[model samples]
Target: MQTVSFLFFNIILPIFIPIIAGYLLQRKFPLNVATLTKIQFYIFIPALLFTTIYQTELNSALLRDLILANLVLFVLLWAVCLICARLMKLDAGKRSAFINSVCFYNSGNYCIPLIQLMYHTPFAFSIQIIVMLIQQLLTNTVGVMNTSSANRSWKGALLENFRMPMTYAVLIALLCRWLSIDVPKPLWTSFELMAQGLVPTALITLGAQLASTHLYLRNFRVLVSNAMRLLVGPLLAAAVCWMWGISGVVAQVMVICAAAPSAVNTVLLAIEYRSDPEFASQTVFLSTLLSALTMPVVIALVQYL
Candidate 1:
């Protein structure tokens, strides 16, 4: 109970308050969601990724585990999305949104902050960063193909994948690591400063995006989809972690990442793919709002497990 309280007050609350405030402010003074999202996708998130990877010590074991964990979770959620789409008899676009929403968890913005707060160690945070990178790559590459409405060309999708800043950052980081190139202190400091803005800006932008959406309080499909995200997703991840003999902080981070509500990127994917962007946006909004409560409960339950 105390642990849950700490997570809520110390970690979750700090992250969310600014977001909620941003939402309110946005409502009062509207801004462009597309412009903000573009900034985040192109600049802030990638900068953060570069800084984190460049500074961290990497190991093959940790990298393999992170990749495996993300792959397993993505596959599981994709299956769930398919089942849900079938049951719902959704059209192609709606089905795509549903699958993207379920499969692309907010492993970066939400999970990283929560892990950093819970573990209070740079090493643990670095693990979360690596896992986030793996998830980002998978979602941007494979997940994009699954949701795209354009001609399904693997080569095109792969080409588009390189356009993402996160991918470029990872490539640079890997090269730097391989070559044992130490970043100059000034450059490292500049990157760190830029990276520091990623989380808060992301959360605030997310909040603003949510505020822009029209949430249907009585939408049963939306409610159930979010329930699957908050409950079933985490349970599946927990089971996998147990089966894989993962324990301690790694297991906790896995569970939390799984438990996170739909990523804001789901809406972006839906829009790009000519899917039901409205539904996708609503799901993202509601899930994020509800996560304020559900995340604490999930964390509390995991503490006992």
Candidate 2:
């Protein structure tokens, strides 16, 4: 079918090709994925976020609607994750990772690309980027607190989020937009160049991350978390869409954004916070692999909706 081919060639192939390239490079040379991730975290992601939000036509009314929709979806997903975590009787660290796995998603790398290819419009892409902003902010703040050591206070975790440059990048962009400040040509062009690398870098690093991780899991809880992420997540997103009276491209974009696999950043957080990186990595890997099959279904489903 044309739909299948379009999804494959346009969506899956673009991501997988970079991943395969990174995988081969890592296998041959054994890269320092952590250092690469640091580059992305400190420089690339911030640049991408700043450029996108600054240039996009994110008006106040649409912004308010998106904020509400994002808020409702996030709470629902967290609640769903908590219910699953309690039922599984998971321990503290693993429960934190499980809840994070279900809540945080690949909004940046996965959803943005699909949105661009599927609709090829700035409005649709910007909507997905706004969702990415919500996910990124939550992953930095709440995610940090959840994974933190007991001795580390929630205040410490909150401050730790401030250390992330991307957070400030977003704030500055928003301020610039509100103040009607413009990014001059040379700087804006450079920002655009940096933004261009985000997707390819993210996908390639994902491959390297996968290559570095030890991925043999016996725990069924991982599967449960993935189900919550890839299955329940979209349902919750759709519910929010309906609740907010969202339809057409915006609704489809929100639902597709929810269907993204666990955030690659979740693994980074687990490793940094001394949580169960093994479990985090395995969950992300499996969810991502499964999403290769599920994305097409969501894509088609969105069309009918």
Worst 10 residues of 2 by lDDT: 149-158
* lDDT digits (tens) for residues 1-305 of candidate 2: 34866777777777778887888899999988878878878888788778877877767887898888988899998887788788888898888999889889989766766676788666787788778878877876788878885546667766776888877888898899889998899998888788777777877888887787666657798888888888888888888988898888888898999999999889888988878888889888888888887787788778755
Q: lDDT (CA) for every model shown?
A: 0.78, 0.82
Which run of 10 residues does model 1 get worst, by summed lDDT? 149-158
Cα RMSD for candidates in order: 2.2, 2.4
Which candidate has the top score in lDDT? 2
In model 2, the runs with Cα more than 4 Å from the true position are 272-274
- Local accuracy of candidate 1 as per-residue lDDT tens digits, 1-305: 65777768877898898788779979999978678777877777777777767767768886677678768877888888788889999888777877777777787667766776677666677777766766777676777887873656677766776777778887898799889999999988888887777777777777787787887888666887898898888999888888777777777777888889888778877777777888888888888888888898888877754
